[model samples]
Target: MCYIYSRLFMFFSLLLLSFSVYLIILDFVYIIEYIFIIFNSVNITYIILIDWMSMMFMSFVLFISSMVIYYSEEYMNGDLNKNRFILMVIMFVISMMLMIISPNLISILLGWDGLGLVSYCLVIYYQNIKSFSAGMLTALSNRVGDVALLMSIAWMMNYGSWNFMFYLDIMKNDWIMELISYLVVLAAMTKSAQIPFSSWLPAAMAAPTPVSSLVHSSTLVTAGVYLLIRFNYAFSSSLMNFLLFISSMTMFMSGLGANFENDLKKIIALSTLSQLGLMMSILSLGAYKLAFFHLLIHALFKALLFMCAGSIIHSLSNCQDIRCMGGLVKQLPLTCTYFNICNWSLCGIPFMSGFYSKDLIVEFMSMNILNIYIYFIFYISIGLTVAYSFRLTYYSLSGDFNFISMNLLKENNIMLLGMSGLIFIVIISGSVFNWLMFDTLIFICLPILMKFMTLLVIMLGMLFGYELSKFNLVYNLLSKNFYSFFFSSMWNIPILSTLGVNYIPVKMGALLMIFDRGWFEFYGGQNLSLLLKKFTLLQLLSLNHLKIYFLMLLIWIIYLLVQI
Candidate 1:
């Protein structure tokens, strides 16, 4: 049995390896496509090859999926769920691949929904109540975004046919085009977990570490920014500027939340959201190339960080609360090493991946048509980013190793080696991609100054954090249910007044609800004894039900009646 199991495992491992090679080949093909388009040798629309952004995205997905597949051999240790987990991982990769290559709106929506569904399953793979609840929250949040996409699709079909080839042609209708663009931005915001939709991301930390690393850092959360990049030409200037403001706000707010988080996973979760917000802000400026460039760097280092966190948790037998962790640097040296590399990159230190990408974003903000105040927002967010990165690195790895028992410090070289490789890549990513696009004076020097300023802020924040640890004031304020409070407060407003009295459906909703519920129950409960009474009432309502029961009943009932 052991021999058979080993053989089967080796076979599957080789299959995953082969897939990784195929993905690398695909990445090269995408690069060639970009070159072709750049020189006008091939029309960008005619070509079906993946673009640069998608290629980078696929590379991260392939790397992380391969790592997870290999790591699962030891991590699962003959558990029954091993097969199920592997299957989900493969499905996750396939969905992400579909998402990357999808060329049109309908295809993109299909891939997007597929990814959301698969990610939810992976999150709830352990069957724990908390995990299940987290998955549901993710699903609910994603569904809201899905509805916006559907509305955009409806608008598209109404203006043109179901054919996406008509998109460019339909652009002549400015109002319709702008409306579709607004809906698309709304959809992207929800999917990317910006502002009001951001709560689901931190909640998603309830999933297993591997799931978190893949979904939170590399693939799922990126879908929003990907959409924004894909449809860059559709949005109006006003809408783009609005998106820029919202994304910058999300970046700052999420970084603040990360600074206050106690759980290891929640900190990374918020950081992922913040980094994505930064990417979206760049995308909103029509800087698609730079946004994607930053996305590639962010994915690599963030995945490395999450995987290192996973290794730490696994070594300590699933302990993830950072407050309980002290000195782990000595005990988990390999993990700590990778964590530091990721932190350096995330903090935008010199010669790191984030320095190149983040500096470009700041440069773009400064040089773009945006106001100086907007640039200031981006600048302050950089400090917040550094502060949170330091908070994560210091509290988890630097304090004292004596806090964790010696017996719990088992090292898995496979996991450690995987993370180390990612860290090495993150260190050299700038040179590998030629991401340094600006002047040395502006890009390197200014960012270094910014980095030091940010570092000082981080140190001060840590000291304040230490003091607040005693009084628990900052911790409590950060942890307060701000999202819940704001949502509840918004709900308390009179919808009719807020939306305009003309927009309100009026009190007729209660009458309809009573009628529909009573009618359904009455008809459903009828038997021979009450059949006559039920039939008489049903006949009276049949005229009304006629509109609901036709071949196009749903459309008329939902659209026409709602409008009325």
Candidate 2:
């Protein structure tokens, strides 16, 4: 049943992809608008903006989702709720498509809220405590973004319309209106898991790999980046600089955290977080197109990377600790090949998908006269990317076999079939997207020293990774220090978010309950009701005798005679 439904979605997705391809070839933009609701002067409508960007993004999403659905057949072969999983994934893709086409804030909420809710469902699909915890975190963190978007919508009421496309140019001159960009950036930060919101991305690994592949890699996480891309025209210089700082810190922090992570899936999740930071940072630098370009390319390789991780995990009986894996190259030759290709692309190796987008972003950042902090974080994060890539590669493919015994690790054909599609794109997506999106390569003049900084850092990172892998006592010893605990625990953001954010509110609620039940209800409500009852009884008692009624009648008669 699951297979049938998955194949049906794949077929439908392919058809959508074909339509998108045709739209892209013609360079056509199709806009559809109709009034959804009208109240006095304010009119909310359904606006779908379909252009090269939307069609391109939609096609990519459909293609990847189709492949993910197909891949899940074998990966989740015996799972009882495989159909539910497939359905959730398809719904996720639909939400992404809605998000991709809408230019209106109200319409965007449909997709954005859909993504947050569906991702939570998918994350908790495993029905375990870890999934529950992770789901709550993922949902709550993204909920912040949802609230921000809602606030932006409310703020947009100043313009008398929800369609931001019409207001971007005019918004720049209005200081109060420009505040929407800050709200948008705040929303983007949470959605992209920047800094304080960073904990959820790594914890989201509790979800199944397919969810990680589709939701985390491309759709759910990148929604914020996509939103910023749409809102790029309205961002003030101050907002951009602020976004730049936050995103830079996010990129650096995720990179540093990845270096200390041992869980294979969490490491990849951290890498995704780091790449997200890069995209956000570039967008903050006012290069929306470049950020969008990287978003697409990163989606390709990161999906493939997660799929490879899933395959390896499936073979290893669900083991995800990189320390437990070694010398897989000999056992899972094809899987290792795919894994390395994706890893190399992630490192931004020349001619690969990541290089086209990532290297250009860095080069452009270098050419711009930015602050020293931005410069340092950008370059260091890039190098850290390579460092973690090497560390992951060494631990999984080249290190001594740490498994207890020789184990069977045959490649699953169906899984490989799904990966094969991405593998081809991982190799060609860069050149293809570059040709399709840009008329000419972005030109930047730099000295020889600057030109090769990325390479130099990558090499340095490799050497550092290799030496650290061997001489780990010092790094390990350093990791035991107080600051190390902070880094390893993601600066205790998870604890803060879960414990810190939740504790005060929960405690306050308990105190409120005590007040309500003990004092407020007893004295203010219950005792008040009892006092009213006693007063009524006293009034009745006062009128109990027939003489009292006669006395009242006589008083009324006297008052009437006096008035006459």
Top of the candidates by TM-score? 2
lDDT of 1 by residue, 81-146 (tens): 777777787777778777777666666776789888988898787788888877887887788888
lDDT of each: 0.70, 0.87
Across residues 419-512, which tens digit of lDDT does each residue of candidate 2 receive? 9977998899899878878756688899999999988887888887777677667878888888878887877888988998889988899777
Against the true structure, what is each candidate's TM-score?
0.73, 0.88
Positional deviation of residue 289's Cα in model 2 after best superposition, in angstroms: 0.6
RMSD of 1: 13.8
RMSD of each: 13.8, 14.4
Could you tell me the lDDT of residue 71 within candidate 1? 60
Residue 331 in model 1: lDDT: 78
How many angstroms is residue 49 displaced in model 2 relative to the true structure, after the best TM-score fit? 0.5
